[model samples]
Target: MFKTNETQMQIHSIRWLKVIDPDQEYITHISTQFSIPRNFIQTALDENASARIQCKQQATLIMTHLPFNTSSKAEQSVSCKSFAVIIKDHLVFIISKHDHPIFDQMIQYVEQGPEHSAEQLADYVYRFLELAADQFIVASKSVNEQISTVEHELLSSIKNKQVFKLLNHNKVLNRIAISLRGNSKVLNLLNDMQVVTGHQAAQHRLLNVMVETDQAQAMAEIHNINLSNLMDAYSAAIENNLSLLVQYLSVYVIIAAIPLGIASLYGMNIPLPLQEQPYALSLLAGLSLLLSVAIVIIFKKRQII
Candidate 1:
């Protein structure tokens, strides 16, 4: 029953159980072994779950979105997943669908640091939130870099690919913004709750987490607005370029049609003015050229080109 890839460690005076990508059967086993609320675990596993906190009996459940870098080093994009933390008196169970680098960082910090030895389960929760906020900051910086790259590329030439890239960045920013708001809500609730306020240390840590959460949220919002404006400007430029191209094409078509209309009269069976003249072909050619030039001059004076 314990054959799964779950990592159980002793952090300070509490037992930390980290479960990744657990099956329903394993979740049932964990729920039975640790007496955790099964519903909390299920809620965390949900892909569409929002950040929230709940208390049931002796267990407290904290759900938060964990942001991860879904892009490679050359490119930057962010994606979020929900994770659940169930805190009992001496046991802390963290359940998520996938492992995050933040978890490893948490373990390493606890193992190498002496200051956190006296930390409680609530402190770890705050630390997790702070780390998550830091990830958002990193992601936001990456987005800013990407926007610069896209702008440079657009200056050279605009293409469908660049438009798609902007749309993709917009989508990522939207998700990050939403996740940050949810995180802020959870942090606010935790800060006001008696469970955190009663403990001075925990309250201080919670306040720090709250500050980081707000910063991340603000960054996301600012970046999102900038991205929206960039997209709008790009679209307007593209439309203007297309309109200019059509105007030039129309000017050329009218110039060409003047020559064609003059030549077409010679095709008629009736006695045309230059149809029988010995120098008619040369005169007609000169007339067409002259008329085309005049039309161009008229268009230029009107600023149609």
Candidate 2:
């Protein structure tokens, strides 16, 4: 059954005895039933509890991180909040600070079981954690695809179309990294729990999940690094292109200035060497053509054109 506290799902579980408050009566009841210390129960019930594994006189009390979706930005962040307690063969409890879709789904599956065993209960918890890992994998894959798309666009000739996409890709990568780190912590906690319980199969499964997650994280990191490098290379290429363009324009400017300078000098209306010669205009034109050809030859020789 689901309980509400301030409009948030207070507790979710299948065959577990859930206690929201560690008050006098609640503590006394759990203590009597489980032969456990009231202090241990109280500590477990603390909302500000840390992830830990504690052994009581009667049961093994474990507090582990459970994944939750708590992102407020375009990129979603994964968060972990305390979830369950396994008190011996008779009792299991799940508590949450808020509604969790993963735990809720586990509850539904457990309810469908005709009878429950301690092994089944443990397996259910493991399955919930595995499912959480699966979600992370899904999110990582989605982000990776997005990065690939953005990288392709950035590499193409359409700079205007790719700029916004690249920015969004970076944002997504950052968010995914945050979520991956969080999920990794939870996965480690789960693996540690399995080790403590001596559940070899669960440990193997958890390790596999961790491996998959690490691969995804690595892919995201590599893509981010590659994209940054590509951007730097593109910027350098653009700078080189601009330098070549400036050099070409400078040569043209010098060539064009020669004609202007000659006209300006002749416009003084003073006597000049070829002012009244019969073939002066033709000779001047011919000299100008030769000079232009010489400039072209110089540029070609220097490999500047």
TM-score of each: 0.79, 0.49
Off by over 4 Å in 1: 1-4, 69-77, 115-121, 144-171, 194-203, 229-235, 267-283
Q: For model 1, which pairs clash?
A: none
Cα lDDT of model 1 by residue, 278-303, tens digit: 99999998999999999999988999
Query: Model 2: runs farther than 4 Å from truth?
Result: 1-171, 194-204, 273-286
Candidate 2, residues 1-305: lDDT per residue as tens digits? 43332111212332454455444665576678667766666665554456566666756665654445556665444443554455564455554445556655666666766545544555655565566556656655665576566565445342444545555555566555555565566667756655234255545666777786677667667766766666666555556666777898999988877766776776787899888899977877777777887988988998978
lDDT of each: 0.79, 0.60
Root-mean-square deviation per candidate: 4.0, 8.2
- Scored by lDDT, the top model is 1
